[model samples]
Target: MSRRHVPAVLALVAGALVAVPAQAAHAATVQVPCSVPDLVKAINTANGTPRADTIRLARGCTYKLRAPDPVNPGNGLPVITSEITIDGRGATIERDGQGGEVPRFRIIYVDKTGVLKLIRTTIRGGYATDCPAFPDAVGASCGGGISNNGKMRITHSKFTGNTSASPVFAQGGGIDSPGSAKSTISDTEVSGNHVVYTGQEPESGAAGGGISNDGPLTITDSKLSGNTATVTPDTRSTAFGAGIISFFGTTIKNTVISGNRAFAEKGTARAAVSNGIPADSGRLTVIGGAVRDNVSDAPGGVAQGGGIANNALMTVKGVKISGNRAVAKDGIARGGGVRVGPSGTLDLKESRITGNTVEAPGGTAQGAGIDNPDGGVLRAERNEILRNTATAENGTAQGGGLYHAAGLPASGTSTLKRNTITDNRAADGGGIFRASGGLTLNGDVVRENRPNNCAPTGTVPGCTG
Candidate 1:
């Protein structure tokens, strides 16, 4: 789950599953008991089992997992090779690797593409020192969680209070999905998982506080709360997605992303601190959920969809984005809710985007809600865009509610239809700023969303405003 070879294995398995001709075989269920209260032995037995197998863990048992082998040569910890399914029966697999070595290991690692399923289990990624200098890297950071590289399906599972470092870094403190792994996580609760990237100079590397998805991934109908992705600037890296970081093509639907934070000041003196879905390539879609009460020094800067520096295409439908703040004392910033690059596109449909803010108290430029640079595009339909503010008075200019700078083409090309745009304030377009590029509107309620434009601050001809 930590390295990239697991995904390769999954690809091989999926290919084998699809290509290999086989007669219909009855499903084989293997019982791997942690009856001795030894979670590590149970895991080792399950992992050592052959492929096309199912491991059913006993119910009502409490497993104290042992420390992983310290001499794992490649990457962090050993890899789970078999195409196996591990099922926990109302059991708790806790990380019991007490204070010994500086490094630690993950709880469940699904390596191949075969179905790896879990039911009614609590996986606790115990606690460990996740500093950059630690021997183990992000994937193998201590804890009782799972690193999934293939098809990982979880139902009725709980993840609690997994800590990477004292402060937390970009470790998969709770659940880590590396790449090209398809996951179905239903009825799962992930809480209090912190990637404490506390090092002498924390800014050197970035960490995934709760969940880090680097490839094509999908998470549906889950709860992620109270997770922290904190990094020290001295480490010279980015700390983001205190709750979740989705790179590559990722889709999260019918889930809640709340109370997560990326605190960069505690570690070192890094320039930017990011949280919640740091920028990367691919398609990210968030539908039917809320992204609220999450914070970062620069939360989702220069990107769209959700949170920091995203370069992928972000599409949000039937979602609520409220009380999310993007803060940076530096002079330059954009897209408080989303800082989209010049080429990225942000499309929101039937979504309520309210109470989000972009503030640059120290430097100059900033945009409150959506900052579409010269080539960027922001399209909203059948939604309420309200009460968002951008507060940069001294030479801080552009669309306060939404800035369509000369860099990002005209809003004339962007579509704002059947939307209630009101009560938003800023230096430029207080309600919405169509600075240079024009925005198009159709059947939109241009209520009180006001901007400080030069001409009539009313609806401009091009912005259907």
Candidate 2:
């Protein structure tokens, strides 16, 4: 335990340090040059390395791929299999294939072992062709921009001009995160994305024009607009969420979903945002966002759930759902603002649903503002549902502000408190309509509609014209 032993210990420590690989000591920072091949090589090197790496891309460069990557077939870059963060200095990574026909392959694919953090990048012109069965390869031929099965955090980015097309079904025109992925997207713009599916079932058909999150995901301070989800299913099913669809527990905070369209051969299901599935329960919490100017069109079926659709346990707080439309060319039009499905339960508070509309060219137009017609429940408090309209070109209109078909076929409850339902227009039940269900209204004002308020006056107690 003296100076002689100190020299021996120091020698042993130096030998051990020499045995450790340089990459294992700490994460490396890789700088990619201003060229396509260089970017690909950098990604490949970082992915092949044995540690987390930060790849700093060339500033203001456009690394466009000329062909498919050999490492990851049908992709623009190597498959991500390691923890890597691409610090893009206002750059773009896209595919520039033959004739620029929206390159058939996607831009990025993150494997299950990967953890990708992409920042300050723009991804565009990614076109994903379809597959007959999804949830198979995260539906390999989907998610035009990025197909993520691992952890991903994307911030300060843009995804535009991406597309998903299929003869049967497709999803995630811009991005798809599935299979137990941990994803967070913030300060992003996801617009001009499109999905088209011509299948027989809308439930598995065109969905999530902007982003699809079947995993646990959190999106904040993002804008999703001008996304289209079109489904031509032969039969009846739900094509949900033209702007965004989540089938798992999701949180969307301070995000704006506007100008998205959902069109179906049968029905649009929902235009702006759709949450959850019917067989299994899900949860979605939307706080302080705007869902505006979204459209749900169905020439073959009904126009339902124009602004927001929920089949999960959803909670909407301090949000605005206005200027949305539900158009039906041959069937009925309902739920111009928000629709709660048979298995859904909505807890909407401190929100506004105004200036929404429903139009049926040959059928009835009902529930111009909000509709809870099935077994689902609606507990809306401290909200406003006003200035909505229901118009029928050849039939009748009803339920201008709110419609609660409580016990027609299924039994549910509608408990409304501290809400305003006024200045809506319809042929009947201009403010509120209750075909049947256990309805409890307290601290609400229903007035100044086109017709008298609350049809079948005796059906609702303590309310009369």
Q: Point to the candidate with the largest TM-score.
A: 2
Q: What is the clash count for each candidate, in the order shown?
A: 65, 3
Per the 3 Å backbone cut-off, how many clashing residue pairs does candidate 2 have? 3
Per-residue lDDT of candidate 1, residues 72-123 (tens digit): 3221323455455567778887756467643455555555433467788888
lDDT of 1 at 89: 79
10 residues in a row with least lDDT, candidate 1: 7-16
lDDT on C-alpha atoms for all candidate structures: 0.57, 0.78
**Alpha-carbon TM-score of each model against the true structure:** 0.76, 0.90
Best by lDDT: 2
- Please report the TM-score between candidate 1 and the true structure: 0.76
Model 2 per-residue lDDT tens digits across residues 1-465: 111111011100000011111335588998889888888888889878888899999899888877767755556788887888998989988777657554487788777677889999999877775321133333324688887777789999999988877655567889887646558999999999987775553344567899977667899999999999887654564556789987667899999999999887665446578866423424788999899999998876877789998766889999999999988877877889998877778999999999999888878788888888877899999999999998887786888988888644669888999899889988888888878887788988877887867886777665566
